[model samples]
Target: MYNIHWEEKALHELEKLDSKVSSRIFKKVESLKEGLHLSDIKRLKNSDYFRLRVGDYRIIFSFEDNTITVWKVGHRNHIYDRI
Candidate 1:
């Protein structure tokens, strides 16, 4: 099992999303605790970050030492800009 941590900025971004979208995102994050692999995850070039897709939004995170740190959450258009 991996511990999931959310950066303050990521949490704030989530809070600004629609409730339904937020709920789905939460569910997907929780699934990471159950041992999800990185087969479908897209790695950001030249970075330690990876991305998980949830509908039109994206979850940007990094994994290290049994911990996953979510750095940002936003729609596709602006998510990469912040990263």
Candidate 2:
């Protein structure tokens, strides 16, 4: 299993969600740590970054070695030109 670390931005966004939604999202993210495809993740471009969908929220992260670093968590309604 890969280690998972959440950035301050992700943690902050997580706090904005209701307990049930937040818990479910966390579970999905943790599940990915166990084993996820690089093909699925590589779409994020360089730095081994990726984004996972959880309902209306988006999880931006990166995988390095045996760890996953969550960079941000945000609603789909927002515009993020980070790409």
Candidate 3:
């Protein structure tokens, strides 16, 4: 199982989202601990980060040494800009 760590910015972004959306994202992230691999994920160009798509939102994260570090969470149009 991999450990999941959320960055402050990502947590703040999640806080601003609708509860339903935030709940779904949180569920998905938690599922990663069970060895679930999201087929919808995409690796960012020239970076170690990968993005997981959850409806209209996107989760940007990187995995190393059994830990997944979430860097940002936002809508599809704006998520990439900040990363």
Candidate 4:
């Protein structure tokens, strides 16, 4: 199984999201470490990375070595507002 790394950037993103959605997003991240690669992950570009849709929010992340690092989490309309 791969290791999941929650960078301060990602953790901060989680803090800004709704509780239920945040929980679900984390669950999915954990599952991915266990080898669940869905269409969403498969569709990622080499430089683009993976993204999961939680309502209108997007969980953006990437993998390095055996670690999955979540990069950002934000609504479809608000993602660009981050950073």
> Which candidate number has the best lDDT?
1
Query: Model 3: runs farther than 4 Å from truth?
Result: none
Superposed on all Cα atoms, model 3 deviates from the true structure by an RMSD in Å of 0.9
- Model 1: pairs clashing at backbone N, Cα or C within 3 Å: none
lDDT of 1 at 27: 87
Off by over 4 Å in 4: 42-48, 80-83
Candidate 3 lDDT tens digits, 28-80: 88888766367977899999999888999999999998999989999999888
Which regions in candidate 2 have their CA more than 4 angstroms from the true location? 38-42, 45-48, 79-83
> On residues 1-83, what C-alpha lDDT tens digit does candidate 1 reach at each position?
99999999999999999999999998898788867584657899999899999989999999898898999999999999987
TM agreement with the true structure for every prediction = 0.94, 0.79, 0.94, 0.78
How far out, in Å, is residue 3 in model 3?
A: 0.6
Better of 2 and 4 by lDDT: 2
TM-score of 4: 0.78
Cα error, candidate 2, residue 81 (Å) = 4.3
Local distance difference test, per candidate?
0.91, 0.76, 0.90, 0.76
Worst 10 residues of 2 by lDDT: 38-47
How does model 3 score by TM-score?
0.94
Off by over 4 Å in 1: none
* Cα shift from native, residue 69, model 2 (Å): 0.1
